[model samples]
Target: MNTQPATRPAFQDRHILVTGAASGIGAAVARQLLAQGARVSAVDLDETGLQRLHAQAPHRAASSRLEDASGHLWTARLDVRDSAQVEQVVAKAQAALGPLDGLASVAGILEMGEVVDLDDAQWQHCFDVNATGVFHVCRAVARRLRERRAGAIVTVSSNAAATPRAGMAAYAASKAAVTQFSRCLGLELAPYGIRVNIVSPGSTDTAMQQAMWAQGSSRAAVIQGDPSRWRLGIPLDKIATPEEIAAAVLFLLSDQASHITLHDLRVDGGATLDQG
Candidate 1:
């Protein structure tokens, strides 16, 4: 009788880097990757949140005894806004965790206001983190992945990128930028056997979403369309969990999606009415 343990995880022995790992979608992706036996290099600007994530997935630790084992999990404090900092961190993470097999850029921010009322800083900041931040990480990782001749990359965009939303002009535009950028990058990396894709989630049950909710009516408002705001409700009639989004991301990163590339998978519960 063969009693050798079967590898239950698809990501076992693979190295993946996740941005925005402190909270929301990034944190969820990190947790799922760790659970799936991936060597994860979790990066985010929030030091405390990274610590909590590291502690929660102790079993995923590279070494049960060593405090800083890079075998299973590693965490780094990173601000994606700075290109140099992003480059340095990616290098350090790749060095510590091993060559990267996958990269998930989940770091983003939200600032809402009427276009007329929105300040210059707000608009720039939105693009800075949402679009430029993605550019920074993707550029850094793509170089190494290209050299290795293989890898998968998933960028977490938003449904708003496809559909218009009131008071979300900046956020919507930034997401649009990432969506197009990912597709173009996919084209560029195709010859190298590297795949790039996008996952656009809508109204997920994350701190970022909850923060946008009103005291009592917000949840219902999100479920039931608000014609006044030119917003349609989710057809599924519920918010998504971060894990749900993470699942889609993992699928794209895994071999199950080997033939898929430059695809934009929307996880919006038909919220956009499938427009365009």
Candidate 2:
């Protein structure tokens, strides 16, 4: 409800591809991009959430909308685990919205369990979505950006990737892979004038965080530490909204961070004490 539009609409006519755009951090990024005048190719595994996002059109002029769109918004049902599907989607999105100005790789999953208790399928699923999925999309888009010789990318990771979490081994490990991968990618793409950065967020108020509550964790416990599980609470005494995380992401993608690359920005409200 506090989704404030930016005072300056700086990205007019720019194209951006947002994964996990159906909800949470991804959804927040998509809305703000539209508000800043970017054309967004919003893809997610959830078709319904995409439809709902398509209905919110105040960010842009109504006349800019297509028959199935709400101005500067294009929706696609994407499962990033499929490399082939990722390639096709990126191609079609560019054809529809023009060359991509940037990308926000926010599609990811969280599966918590101790290392020894983690099943093969569970471990693989986490890496598939959180790590390999990022690889697929980034490769698809980077190939284009390399030739065009410009653009930026921001991959969403988790703060747990920097700090240890007793029951989040799978999720944390996958996000760690994402963090390092983005750094390596930034290095390789630097000469081409493309920027790649990572945004690692702590506890945030979203359906994903609510699901942890459904599993019996209390909000107070999340904000006040959980020693038994080796989890640190937010020092700020509150959970972040997806929009806050999105702001960090957009900054890195914007010209404001033009000189920054291969950096991992933590938006954890001091939860990890600035851990790497």
Candidate 3:
């Protein structure tokens, strides 16, 4: 049994790049890492949200705040799906923050509609953002980690990947792909001492959740009727909060879980169990 101080900072000098850092789970993870004295680089397409994140830590604000615990964090306004942009940003981040120590892939989208009614463009867009976006960031960061012989990666997946829902076909499938990709990455990267893991969250009470609630309820009679049993409803009896999901990511990235890799850690408040 290994015992250490309960309140020690396990990631004091680690550099972490978090996508979707503008809101929801990504934002929470960034904040948690900062509080633990880790160097953190955050990116999102929402420049306004990035500004707000910086504003929250003005005392520690600097151009590369993500790399410098005492200075401002780095915020990039780039879409994860853009491979060129992702490569450029990763290089810049490593140059500014030092080598890439970790990556948290949290940028994704969920579009709910019957698959037959969904357009090809919509399906492509979701996969491009969710699945391909992950590929871009992971490939870029893992390359550096492999060269250095150390690093960790945690991707945000979804419970929908395991339990199919009526209106979440595209979203579920995208996450399923992400899960498989992460597993493959784990095996391929193990030789270089890199660990890859996935965190699959159920409906969390983020802005995304609110949007989903509205979408399903817009047709209350059609969606909530006895025939459907409101099967698509969040299975936890209530939605989780973003912080809950972030905690799981923090654990997977920390030294406490150094031996774990290539697995899906679900933080859905027993939502999947209820459905099962």
By TM-score, the best candidate is 1
Worst 10 residues of 2 by lDDT: 60-69
TM-score of each: 0.94, 0.93, 0.89
Model 3 has an lDDT value of 0.82
State which candidate, 1 or 2, has the greater TM-score: 1
Off by over 4 Å in 3: 1-7, 62-72, 218-236, 274-276
Q: How accurate is candidate 1 locally (lDDT)?
A: 0.90
RMSD of each: 2.6, 4.2, 4.0
TM-score of 2: 0.93
Candidate 1 TM-score versus the reference: 0.94
Query: Backbone clashes in each candidate structure, one number apiece?
Result: 1, 0, 7
lDDT of 1 by residue, 1-276 (tens): 999998678998899989999898999999999888899989998888888788788465444322255458888888899999999998988778789998999999998888999999999999999999999999999999999999999999999998998888999999999999999999999999999999999999887888788534487789898998888999998889999999999999999999999999999889998774
Give the clashing pairs for model 1.
62-72
Error of 3 at 110 (Å): 1.3
TM-score of 3: 0.89
Please provide the root mean square deviation of candidate 3 (C-alpha atoms, Å).
Answer: 4.0
lDDT of 2 by residue, 1-276 (tens): 779875767778889999999899999999999888899999999988887778774544444332234468888889999999999999989877889889999999989778899999999999999999999999999999999999999999989898988888999999999999999999999999999999999999999899988888978989999888777888899999999999999999998999999999999899999977
